[model samples]
Target: MTLPSYFLDNPYNVEGTEVVGNKLSPENELIEYFVQFRNDDLLDTLNTFEFNLEINENLILQKTLMENKDSFRNILRDAITMGTILLNFDRDDMVNINLQGKRLRNNIKINLEVPSNITLKELTASDYEGDVVTFEAKVSYWSKKRTITHMADYKCPDCGDIITRPFKSKIKDRCVEDKVFYEFFKPNISEDTRRITLREISDDFSEGKLPVSISADVYGKTVWEIELSDKVIVTGVFRSIPLRMENGKISQEFIPTIQVISVQNMKTDKMELPDMELMKKFQDLEAEGKLVEAVIDGFAYNIYKKRNEKKAILCSLIGSIWIGQVGKGNPPMIHILFVGDPDTFKSTIMKYVINVSDNCVLADSTTVSNAGIKAIAIKSDDGRWSIRAGLLPEYHGGVVFLDEFGDLKSDIYADLKAPMIDGWVSKHVAGEDFNGRAETGILASMNPTDGVYDDSKSILENLSVLKKPLITRFDLITKFSIDFNNAYDTQIGEHFDKCDFEGKPESFLKDEEIKLFINYVKTIT
Candidate 1:
């Protein structure tokens, strides 16, 4: 067949191709020539096409796109034409095609219609430009059918306005009440799901407090309820639209509702008095010459009763004044002096008292000076200045157990005179001034001069060995005598032995009772 003039005029044809005599008509000849040429070209192209373009398949396309840009463009154009034709023609069928020797470097949009039988798991997108770009997409598929209904009712406590709306899940449900309009979207509910009503109480509107009760149910079975105060507000849904509150004038965003938890006020009862039996037992122990042991045993009980009775004080005297009372007319600072020979249980008792007391200070002559009790100023990391109780301040309402009292320098002893009597310590350390009253007792134990008590020596003479002012500071002074005479020694030893052998030994009262007593004294003081 002869080629048509139009075929030769086609731009895709060579730039200067002449037309021969037309064997067919103008229109029919153009169609026939184009078909023949296209058939021939396609046959020749298919025959020569190399399925294996490069030995390295991965490098073939990348190399072609970079080295021969025109070829890459031609391949891309052909791919797009092919894709459009396939999409428009076989719109319901799935077709796969691969573009060879081509590179993609821009965004591409695609619309997919999910099959009714297929469920969508996830959706994602990738950018060929390697730049951050956000793309939004959604999945559409047929889902199991169900019904959902939303019934909303709200009351304005202040305005006395009531609004109610009924919405059905199958179609559009709109309601207008109290001069306000609402559009509700019904959610798909499964067979196992049920509808619930929630009420939210908030303090956002009225200043008055509201009493709210909250309850929950599953499948018509009640689960729990809580009583909440008006200060709290609840606003989230379980699988449907949750209860919400609006200020009658404006339509606010929906908020989930919450249940309030109620609390009960607890009343503390007064402690009851000890029975007569307990008191009689303590009295019997005291009468049997076990006063110290009895006191230790009943110390906690006594202090508790005494405290409830509002007694004056509870004091514990160990190596030094290990405990005292705090009240009006009580001294702010109490200086306790321990002046005795080594291994006299003075230091042991002082350590015990210090451990049991809430606060205590153990200082010797070196740590303390004539200046006064050293009060260290401590500033917390949070920028708060805390007057940390030093040995004296720490033991302010407790005891300051002083060991080696006689060993203290004369000047230091003299400095303690005023604090011991007046209960005040004036400290001037690092140019910082601290003056406070410490209401504590001074229970001091002193050894007689020469390490033994001399009966012939007068009380004034014995105390003269110490500073005059220091000696006069003590309220009661007693000397512990170690009698060398066998009669007196045996009598005491046999008595203690009988007590240990016949009754509960004094040593048995060493655990919780003694600890409770020490703690009780410190706490009350």
Candidate 2:
């Protein structure tokens, strides 16, 4: 019952040992082997039709099967249908072929890996219509994993008639005889299906734009394996289905979903590195001259003075480029605190830093909580508790701007101590540990207790409202004072009024050069 030598000798043969130039077998080699084995058994397997073929994930885990997954799937489909026809059995009587694709390891080798390189904001239906696309993003949310009935056989409750249907068919479950109909009960045998949702890793969106929600559906063997909060690179088909409406009106809106084929967790190393060209350009700027000054001027072009403070902010932006392992063995990440009087542009500078940096997070100190600062464990609708990363971990390896710093409660300040000093934050919930490795620089600002810098009191005395443990964590602490009584305020106000009367203010850097400066600062290590 073995395959003939002449059949295996052809260059286009599926199970051939040698492949000729430009000729690829349309059939999977391992699947062809399975077909031969089935034929040699001489057992009437198709006549039994008792769902005996168990071609589940374990068979696909074989090296030969994985290497030829696509061709193997087609071969498996053809073999099942052709076998049923030859045995004079109904194709519908055969068991479902389960090819669990996700059971393959996250780093499984695939021939084609498309790097879409397009942001979630830019994705459109027409751009990649009917094609498979690949992109990398953080997992924003995970829906409850549930087994869905794909196909089933049900028996009539009254007449004892049996009927087969796909899962959730709109057709009524009824048996009819002589124009009389009776309802059917639940299925005795059924198949399984699975689904999940994948979303973009974005928090900020353009004004008036809705968030993107992408769902992925898996069947049989591809079910299970993905976890919440994992950073993944996914290859999937981009398609859309009509949104379900309450009134049943045919609305033009459609929900976007990616039919995922393969996925892998993204490598965490070099997550902070910029593109090579951007790195070279940043290096060239450093090699030239005044790289630090150029970045400072670009931070807030409208403001004047505060070079020393700007330099400290610069360190917070770039942080330290450390090698080897972290923890106590590495230099601590830089943190800066601005203690200033009202109307001195503390909030203004913080906003500018957030805008200029690529991976920055801006949080108002008055509104944040201890759990919100670190990580929070949330329970899903299905009662599964998962840890959702908070603001600090979301912007790791970048800058965090905390404004209105004086309003933070002391207890909330206590929670931030470890992350600021040790470069990691942890949350423990239900015996499960979730850790956020945050190598982020902190840029926080506070107002004087009296709302104005008290000239009569010493510097430390004016800042005594803040806890000493938190204060000591800052690498640089400075006070920004403004001459409120001086006539310069009046002159500046008058100048601003005149400028508004016209159309524009006096500008130094061109818009193009300002953008270049922002990009340069963002590329810094």
Candidate 3:
């Protein structure tokens, strides 16, 4: 077959004899050709063009490589084999081919930025099978990265000829002998690898039901840059590997994993200015000095008294926006522990916060374990490392409410210290290290050791069962007491009566006003 006249144009002006020769392959002409597709300058920086690959838009690539899929397939294989050559990056660094396009149309279009890309829930097995894709997801499990040699020298026993083979290839005789014999020599190359499992996470800052897991293998700088439970947008090629069962039997099913090429951390927060009108209203409220009071009243109307405690919860609701650079700024997250006797309505307060805040993560203390704090890394029966995410990591950048906090094991309470201070948990398991960051505020309620507050004794005396270090971590430690003489305290009795019904009691602040207040508070620097 004769090649098209356009193939000989050589827009890149690269020196080569053949149209698809080793001296100058079409892979080398890809960037240059795309640049000229829009009449872009050859000398300009590559960043000038935006190449976002939306997983939903697969035809963009299929359309581009339609004529010569095999040739580019070989290019992609070579790119992975010698990753450093054409891209001018390390062998471990991934090379992404970003293809952006419109939805529901045969014709594709490229945009500088693709707004509102498809979520992980929208992706099917066929969408990602053998092509490069991009999507936003949360990190559920992070495996400890290990350095292994890729290229190794081996001497064939038959011919005594030194030959090179990748780490996967078994020693064999290609030099004339029917029987294979080889001697191991030193390795020549090393690679950094960390495999991470990503799940379709709800971006609403609430802990929702996670979909099935997708495997993503991050290399080089990305291995260190990505963290567990982080919301990230990643671009990579979908690769399928043979599935091995627990008994080491290779199954017919193939597991899909992404060879990550680029990754970007997506900002996640509960409160968002839905529109400019809401933003204007928030600005007006801020100017009037009613925004703060409105926010406090929004959630506190359900709870009876304890104005100070309500204010503390409000502060926790709108955590500090500033992250310290020079030194640790005031711990942005406010952890509140309510120690009270039975019938103090401590659990009621917790329930109120859970209902009011959209970003609240509620869990019973009975259900929490040491592994529930961050991530649990366990060696599977198959001798492979497996990780499970805990409540704290899953609810990062949100509120964590533990009702019946006193019932938690001693070790569990001890585990809260790291998350309280540093806002993250670091654990090393199965010969791998993992750091899970949960920048979350905590609200917990528990009964005192003696089941009642002793005013005659010191504050520490009443809470002797709990450790001092754990007690000190709480920003506000309030004791809820009932004035026993007044059995029909209108406030407390009315609260219980109101809560018994289906509907919530009417609040002075309207729901829209509260939402506006939340939107306003989130805008604070």
Candidate 4:
């Protein structure tokens, strides 16, 4: 029999048994009583006390019930607790379930693994943060290809001569025309032939199966050795003859010769020379001072941290200009003027840089007056033209240390104008245009006009050595001063005592330190 008309005709009823009752229905009193009774039964079955209706639209509830009538109530309750379904039972026609923001948590985790073979290079804190920091590091690993010495032993079958030699081969000919004819009476033909010929082969031939040894040493360590059969054939053109005479009579003669032949199949193998082991030995030797290592240790502590303020400034400025010119491939000639107090290290650093560099000259400005740092015309006994390089020209690829730079005569100062900028100094001495380019870095030092530098006045104003064009050529200018407040007499006394105890000569401080500093600078470049 069909159920009651109310139950069957209810639009919210999805199936025969499962029915969703709407709160906004006109028969709310009856629906509420039925819902309350059903909730009580569900609480008893599940052993839970609280139960609340997550009210949803009537049509959506009806549709969900229709799709899964058997599990409709359980599904509805789970959806409400998980926040996956939005509900509104007040309006029947607008009811709809949106399944967009649904998520579930399970037993899952993510991990990333890096391979062992991949190595990081130049890794530092600055790399991660993109900043610059100062630090020192040693060269960890270095690889360089070096020439390997090889020797071979072979006998010439045709000459019946035993020849042991070091051999090297090169491609001497390529594909060529086979008996080609130039005249119309003959036909021309070509053949492909790639051949190699021995260019050099060493000489060492001794009879019998003697103990032949071959060894290769890399960085003073033997890495490879091989002993081969004595019957190997040698191929090459003979350039020399080895002969023996008994009692002025010819007994035997060994003639060396070469013949073109093809090597059927060639095989090659490589042996890694012992490097790590030899490096360890070098390290041990370095520790014992038998080998020198590039490490700055006690040197820094023993050497005083003396700074030549003027020289440092000059180097920095000139270094910048030099680097700029190197970039443009048009480096300029440098001229500097240093007017400062006496006893300063003006000439010290100048001489230091000159000795350490590739080519340089140190001279007083007064000595280079008439010639102007370039050759002048001079008649020879044979009356032929001859040109000689002046002091500046001789200093190519290096620096010229000028002492007493501003002490030169005024006329000689004008001669420096062109060379300082254009790198050419010209003079009409001896009826010739004695012109030469001064492709050198200039470091000139001089004393101040009043014998001491004055900090109150500008450096350019105090030093009269710098004039308009000459002053502009300088990249930097600095003044040196001695501090009066921190004058410690005890320090000087201690230095004197140390010098006496060490039995150091009078010129020890000046000459020794300068020599050491020059040697150190030489290694850097």
Top-scoring candidate (lDDT): 3
99-213: candidate 3 lDDT, tens digit per residue: 1100101111122122234666665667757665678887877666766665567777667777656654566545556346666766644546777888875422223333556
Better of 2 and 3 by lDDT: 3
Backbone-clash count (model 4): 10
Would you list the C-alpha lDDT of every candidate in the order shown?
A: 0.35, 0.55, 0.59, 0.36
For candidate 3, give the lDDT of residue 259.
70
Residues 1-525 of candidate 1 have per-residue lDDT tens digits of: 122111122222232222346332232322233234334432233233311122123433344344433233233223332323222333323222122111111111111111121111111112111111111111000111223333334444344454444333222322333333333332221111121222222111112232132221111011111111101111111111223345654333322211111111111112122346644644576688764544443333211122211111124332223244533254444333444444444344444444333334455444444213434443322222423223343234455555456656665566566666655567653234656555455545556667765678776675556866677776545444444588865675675566566664453343334444444333344
For model 1, the run of ten residues with the poorest summed lDDT: 133-142
The residue ranges of model 4 lying beyond 4 angstroms of the native Cα positions read: 1-304, 308-337, 378-387, 425-435, 485-525
Q: Which of candidates 3 and 4 is the stronger one according to TM-score? A: 3
Ranking by TM-score: 3, 2, 4, 1
| Number of the top-ranking candidate, with TM-score as the measure | 3
Error of 1 at 511 (Å): 3.8
Residue pairs clashing in model 4 are: 236-257, 236-258, 237-257, 237-258, 238-256, 238-257, 338-446, 339-448, 340-447, 340-448
Model 2: ten consecutive residues of lowest lDDT: 98-107
TM-score of each: 0.34, 0.56, 0.66, 0.35
Clashes of each: 15, 1, 0, 10
Higher-lDDT candidate among 1 and 3?
3
